[model samples]
Target: MTTDLGMPTVASDPHGHLRGTEPFPVAAHRALADTQLRQNLGHATRTIRAKRAAVVGEVDDWEELRRAGECVKADVMARLPELLEQLEASVTARGGVVHWARDAEEANRIVVGLVRETGSDEVVKVKSMATQETGLNEALGAAGIAALETDLAELIVQLSDDKPSHFLVPAIHRNRSEIRDIFLREMPDVDPDLTDEPRRLAMAARAHLRRKFLSARVGISGVNFAVADTGTISVVESEGNGRMCLTLPDTLITVMGVEKVVPTWSDLEVFLQLLPRSSTGERMNPYTSSWSGVTPGDGPQTFHLVLLDNGRSNVLASPDGRQALHCIRCSACLNVCPVYERTGGHAYGSIYPGPIGAVLSPQLTGIDGPDDVNASLPYASSLCGACFDACPVRIDIPHLLVQQRAAAVEAHGRPTAQDLAMRAAAAAMASPGRFSLTERVVKLGRLLSRSGRIRSVPGPGAAAWFGARDMPEPPAETFREWWGRRERS
Candidate 1:
């Protein structure tokens, strides 16, 4: 077993942790106000949603396959610790080294130190969420090592120094013209005159990355799944860039969460069907690469697998919450999420965003245990179960959101106003006398209305409601009063 070396030290403060500092609603408020962002998000999500629906419709057994996938993941979690040791043993037997990481800082340190040991100042990267979650590029930058993103969208995000706005399409926030500008500005030797065309943009990125691919001695990646039976790691991508990064480099380091492991190769077949159809709306990815340890003179001879904990164990500890770890990162949940569609990914303030992020981030980091913003994540969703239906893994996000909200309320103590209001509401509605009195009070509220609408209101709850929406005027008579009059007649 290899010890995790060079782990980064994160701030110890709970309220001020990196992922929890930004509130989704606050960030989403700004994103919503940007008409351009709204247009971009609407267009992108609608297109992907349609495509996914079309492809998923082609499968007669899609629902069955989804259930199967979820089952395999649950099974993996059930036997996680034992399976991890089994995976470690299998990988070692196959000439691969395994390292364990407890958190993001440790994962980053292990990856950076591995690259440093390769004696390379540069490393080629496959589009990996784990690295992004750990801010690997930023860590490498601080160490004076350049980590080049080989995926086209990821390359665009890296070049722009912008956070990803979506899971599958990181550059979804930017249009073609914006991409052309980034390439022209960042790529030193690119042709000065570039057209805002998709083909041209792809070719330019290809040219820019080609040199790095050939010269870089080390490569870093995240796995879609790690099969324990054969000790194999898998990467699925539309672009062949992932394959290039996996194959071309002499030293390869893959950072994967412990939950990514499955018990056997057969279990991987279930995800192979679920991920592609859910994510890209394709029957199969163009490139599906699988490697088991070192292959003499074929691909990288030196292989290192970093198994990351990074709060997953905490997520797994909760019986109701553990399903959050079942996510395949296919991002199907994001495409269909109303909240994700409008707010985009950055609003969540974590690498993991969208419906999955709403539940996963809070649980992995804890609602009240860490960042104030993290605590606010449970409120990010509108409690719609669209995410649950869209999730190929069947993570009941609405259920998880409620659980996290309960957890958050417990941690911070119930809001006195809300608690008191609920108590008052229960008392009023529980009896006809109290209900009549409440209706009469609301009838008096007619005095506050102008133009047949209560455009604005004064109390905290009233102001909170009217701040975003207008409340219609209350009726002159309660239904009970009308019912009483009819009965007397």
Candidate 2:
């Protein structure tokens, strides 16, 4: 089965069943009720925001680089189908197999079949949003394959059976003490005396993952970028686990979003500079591993690249929303977004969250109806434009938000009460006589006011607005009336 976006029915709920079931406001309300969650999110976002600001300030040509990245991505999106074909050809020539999946179910079936062919019941993984977006781990698990996450933060999320809250720092909502508790409770082999100290935690996780790395014969990962010109794939990480997964396994399978491809190796220059600084706030990532196809007796002897569309092709079809494909998953927007800082990623109800998610998810899901989980996502933003400034590829997120809002409203099939009210206001303002009469009508709001504020409005669609706030008393005289009086004086 396929959605209107051509996403496999299986991939429709990429966030797992329960998480993506609710609208953004419902999820956000629950999240807001958790005071500890708010504190953790606030502190983590503030810290990352500061680090990003400091490092980004050090770059002399950051804006130029952002433009360059944007231009390269625009070119990539324009020729994505061609580049993907070129990439497939290049990979095939280099002894790697490429599989194209239209949606999550197909991707999972392909991967599960591949793993089954290898006769491996277990696989180690580096953090890959593509796989996360497809719910690969759960699929593999249902197929009786254990997918072990090797990235520390991902490992933490996996061990605790929790969803990732931030793109860069998946467990950003968890503090050191909280991590220690998770480790103690979940890791069977963890030291009974394990301390919450950073070094101790690192050592503990290392000890746990080391055995899996050595024993695992199959590894699954996500690509940071695919070079269509060279058939080369890259994975950048602060930790060396990605390198281990790329090299140690006998069979390596990389699931990459179709949008992750760049036309050439030269295009990497702009992104490499933009990503690390924007993501980890470092001058350079600690580890960047790149490989092309298979090499005998060196890395994985069997290599497979699964290019996943899910709803990427659907997103590409949009002229206004397509800019979302330029996202590098830097999480800079997430760190800077006031809404995300307060509510956290879980509230967005997708593997993706924050400002980029707000714009991207709605388009990806095709906004099935007013009740769609994704329908609420476009309204998840404050439209502050901070996300645009923080974006490495310069996606105008606020513009896209408005675009998705229109899409959602149109998908509703009729004018909402709010829409009718706005239309009425527009009509009233279109003529001077109507506008003056409307102004006089508004003046009657004084009768409903108490202590100079209208605390409650008694009408359909008015409660949602008035429940959260008090409207100020209308001015006694219209601007035009005041202007006329001044002229007379």
Candidate 3:
């Protein structure tokens, strides 16, 4: 991957709920006020971080594996077109029909049409970020189809009519006690005696979905990886829900991003090892399901693969930002993000959240206009570089953040106040005489200082700048003056 991460955020633009309604700062302020949410997020992220560190530490050549994964993903991106075409041919040859979609609207249309052809109004769905990005469930519902989420965490979020806060554990923002309340209120046949126990909550959800699982004829899922060589589709999950949906349904429809295609099974192997460790802190997932099209008496009777672009081509067209497509949906960055731990995923305003989301979401929808809320996403980070260090594919996220920030500012047209100020400073520092004059002018800021810090200023521009931030008082002696005296001595 290129070390330079900045690429223009403007692209084909996304068609679903990928863009948030409000800016990051506004949403973050609201999220920060929710003490319970902060508590839940802090507890969940810390636990996951500890687990990931423990498992990641066990491997002697973990960095090598990370490098290998990075290389594989880079290769995939370089040959993505060829790999996807090969994948289409491979899947088509293996009794699977592949349909291509340019955007979320078309993908949802294809999926909804397929379900309509099945003549089944109800379909069982495993958690699919691709579908989430497309707003697939809502689309299906509008078409008179009921898409039921089978993943326990996804189910909880669905039941509560809430958005997922964490990628691995969608309901991470909610505690066990809150979950018990949701189960009691939402699940029709939930036991009144259910306690705030993990086993009990899982059993409650399982019992509720058991009937739906058995009766569902069409199962919808998101793909983790599509092997172009063998036409194999693999999904790694902690629970058996994905397997149940993949195997039991009469018609299986898989919605996958075009970037999910891997050139070979061996390439897939590297990610299989990297994903579990980076995402769930497990050496291997409990239910790692794979299906190559359809089998007569084995799995689903018919299979369809929907390959979706949805602005991914625009992302790929980018020189450095395309490393986002390399993401394995591990959510390792989210677990390590200090910002996400405080504000949670809801603040990011995308299906993808945290550090990756901050960069990826803005790139997908881009800055529609000066006021586009997605523009605020690039500034969501502390630039701590924790995310880059945590990433399995080694995406340079801090650099990517800078790239998106520049792109966003460019998209916004005229320079911002900070930009103008930086330019002014650059001009002033061009010569020694100007630099000394600038230093004298900066000392004037000390007049506004209270307790040796400038908390407020008179002018509108200065007021806005100091509204949320304070600047330390200027030193009594300028560095140039001190150096001049030292020379004389």
Candidate 4:
């Protein structure tokens, strides 16, 4: 089916966190000029790619696992409404409250209100993409509440007052030395002797966050997966900070995209296996935490689950585009993506970035028109198909990109110059007489190139191409004529 997913089920923010302000080409141009960013991205992506390749090679049934994950996610999408309802019932039965949010604003409002109910102005947060998507921390801040990020990378991004560049490694664009600089400058408790050494940096961050973790009475997080059969919410991470956030606080708030629910723990198993290898190149995460509702005198006695739709329903409506929801936040596609490796995630302008972001962002917000910033994302790729191969859930990013490109063109509502040119070419090729006339006229282009190269085209549409490079001279004879002569011979 065409990827034109009408409009969002809800009227989402036009320039939501899911969208970037500038177009991809414009952002990418600036990123290309930043030598440090390119270096950081290149080094980090290559290292992760190597690790992922090594570990993935150990799984003989890796492809099978990928297919299984894909099937489970597809089935979940097929029965999403049912599963979400089931999950809500289970959570409520176990004493946890579930809140439904139709958009980012609603989700943020729910979270902010929940924290306010707890009578806490400060909260320690787990690294949550959903919260990031909703600008939850900013929302909390605006409400005079402080949201402190516990994840090491997220902390670095937060301390620096910078946006996350990558989802998994938010500060992947920052090198170690730069990190040391940020920690020294921003971290109130950081040691003056803190070196760029990984251990030292980790210890310094730990020292700084330890007090916050111990004192914070309210915690906020995002779920990696929520099981419908049981009211279990899982959060997997390499660090113990998420565990602290989950357990130390009296009240816990989790905001998750509605698409994150799985029908069964068995379905969760396939993803659990696929996610680790695809993301961190590990057999399993160091910390894979799952909590069901709340337990008396135990971790987070007051639990709240915010189920966020936020344009996800619109993505679900499109058969071609819904596959993006299958992403497990592994960041596998980012590591292997040639475009992402060079430009980094900032260029995509969405909290979600890389190949998946190109398709997902526009689908979430709906492409405004041909000139919409999100519309430029589909063209950010080289269609190399590496993203699909690396994806744990077998999302065909390249196909989705092509589909989104078509949907983008269709969104223009009127034929663009490129559209008109393509239409004329198609019409000409449909008739032998017209084709022959075009072939004769094509020779006229050769006259424009005395140097045997078309330095420029006579239109604005060709400026993007001819501005960068010269085109080869037109052929003296048509391929059809050559074929006829060969057949006669």
Candidate 5:
């Protein structure tokens, strides 16, 4: 029931992301217009949120555990370069080859060249944000090698030619009916009359990917954590697909962000306890795959580990931005984000999405000229503190989002349109003389009003408030005028 998605692997530079000053608000406006997507996102997020809260509450020491997780990641980020070198040495000592990539382009090139050298036309992939950020599938497709996603949600997204909209749940935007449609249309041998039931869909995907699992010779993955002392890569997943991806292939290529390193196997123990509950709301993930380098006649005979920077060092340079690298990929922030609930993940226009994406994406990509989708990402949230509360690492996402917004505003030079409007309003309000002048202007408007409500007003200011709700009419006497007379007494 699986389609052979043989994307052409021809070498080409990935498309430069479109440039604009428009941030997530503009992007979300487009997404919010899609009623179907909003409904799907709201339902999914609410369900996951409740589940996570229940599980998290069951642990009496959840806050303490979360703080420990935060400190562990902070410790790694604080000493990133040295820890990375330690990780490289440990992996190298265990016969693992390590490649360092400075950015997405370099990372993709390294992986593409590695696949080409293996002389294999295909590679199986575990669900990985690093691979997504690099557009590895497109890169491999360019080189004439197809990268097959083995994770159920990722497989669904890939088959549909769609990007993932969530951190953990890649295809969370798609409901059962949509999933059935995707499976039916894209899966080569899927039954035409397959029911849109959840179990049915999973079974169909399972049947389709089974052969790919057995046949894939090269595996690509990103790690949840890398133990520096023991040189082990750990992946926690709900399904067993990661186990297959980790063990089945002959040559395993892992792409890990530099921040994923933990000092020892004992550190893995703490995260192993924290991650599953925080991420999937499970006491334990159904599967947690751990593997070292090569073992004679077991698993992959050749192992290549790509320790990716991909602009992480630049993020680490700023005190505020460095906190972003502490993320555990739990997706807790996504589940609690109101903006993510409305627009879903695609609107963020990066591999990272939701509250974390708002801050992380802009910084990771260096908030550049025309190519940065991340520049506008900061305004994606409503400044609600839900994401910070939900974070396993407690990243203070709302505070960071504000900082990134300031950065974006500064990048645009003097005042933006929104800024100018706010400034004008403040000037009118601040001066008693100006307030009286505005009151006289509004009195003239009240005479023309048929009712005590203003249904619409011309120009940019009215555009926002008039779009959804009615605007109340100006009072006969302004509040300031009343206050002025009382003060005179």
Candidate 6:
């Protein structure tokens, strides 16, 4: 009388906290110190940005498409619960088993149980963000199951024991030579003379994975778009690895975030158009796989769909932050994000990185205090608005950043030095006498000026500000004094 996976029935928090161990600034400081990382990120992002721009320029209706994507996502969020139920019914009707997981642990448990039931110790994986978000590979390993990543980039990351740095290209932080080194070091049976050429690297990875694919009995994936109308789940990928995983395995399991659903097949057209150019800068994905359950004598004989909430419902509750759920995983925001271009993904300390991660992570985890790492995520950006411009659904990431910042400040419970300084400034400016006195007192700082610029400041919060920047010297006379002198004249 054992429940799934030989474990007693138990429930865990659906929104189990997922955050980086270190605060963003601390991590970013270490990341910034790596010159090779900066070079790799700069080169890769600039190339992707150019390609995305050229193809996006080809479409006359790109803005309209963005609008449509936004509208459909909004509709999905508004009717999420109903749509999810409909989706579950549709998949079930089509001979698929649907499981609802409130949080990461539940999803992992469900998936592990399914794999164990199949009696397979090994499973092939298509690159899936949902699985990564839940730490599925680690969970599977802990259960004595091996999850083999078939995607070339993912394989590199797996072999290196490294976290993914970019959304589409998980190993974008590594150059060819570095990838070659990892393969030489970690990949078993790799050719002794393997070169860093892209083709050779891909071939080495392909040969390594082909044997696994042929023998793997179970496959796992993440859904890009789930069509509730037809109970169809779709995965859009550039590599054919996804196809191998989806069709070759006897048991196919797909895990998807609740926000990934679209109302109908027609809704996919807009996303199909938006995702490619914004992501890989292609007119269309090289491989698009869709299935609605088990097909007799074709594809997997068994199908399971895990619908994962994991804080998405909580995200939908916030008016300002809910739009984060509209993300299509295209990584357009990441490609255009200046902050991400420098520090790379690992610094953010979450699978979701860059502009979207900055706002989304804090909301997903809930900012509990000033010391929370998720709270540090909001300040990770420069607020230049490039991410919003590149977003397929126009998420207005800067606005979300501000909202999260305010939320963090309110949650801290104790005033920071900057807060105390602001309060002091507010009191000084509240009355004419105090303001005039403060302005005259500040003019005394001209003693610290060199060539009409204050290169350094000695104070608590002001030191970090002046460390890399110089402030313009105050005017010879305060504005109030100038006004008074003019009146006297």
lDDT of 6 by residue, 299-381 (tens): 99999999887877678887667899999989999998888988999999988999998888888768888888888899998
Error of 4 at 317 (Å): 1.6
Question: Could you tally the backbone clashes for each prediction?
Answer: 1, 0, 1, 0, 7, 2
Q: What is the lDDT of residue 59 in candidate 4?
A: 96
In terms of TM-score, which candidate is strongest?
6
Q: How much does each candidate deviate from the true structure in C-alpha RMSD?
A: 3.4, 3.3, 4.0, 3.6, 5.9, 3.8
Estimate, for each residue in 188-245, the C-alpha lDDT of model 1 and write its tens digit. 7998988998998898999999988989899999899999989999999998999999
> How well is each residue in 1-489 modelled by candidate 2, as lDDT tens digits?
221323334534432321278988888888888899999999988888889889999989899999999999999988888888899999999999999888777888899999999999999999999888888899999999999999999999999999898889999989999999999999978999999999999999999999999999999999999999899999999989999999999999999999999988899877899999999999999999999999888999999999988777778887767899999999999999988988999998888899998887777767876777888888888888999999999999999999988888988866777788999999999999999899999999999899999988788588766755698999898889999999999
- The sequence of per-residue lDDT tens digits that candidate 3 reaches over residues 80-134 is 8788879888999889999888778888888999999999999999989999999
Misplaced by over 4 Å in model 2 are 1-19, 423-455, 468-470, 475-489
* Minimal lDDT window, size 10, model 6: 1-10
Candidate 1: TM-score?
0.93
**What would the TM-scores of all predictions be?**
0.93, 0.91, 0.92, 0.91, 0.91, 0.94
On a 0 to 100 scale, what is the lDDT of residue 258 in model 2?
Answer: 90
Model 2 residue pairs with clashes: none
Residue-by-residue lDDT tens digits, candidate 4, 252-287: 999988989999899889988999899999989999
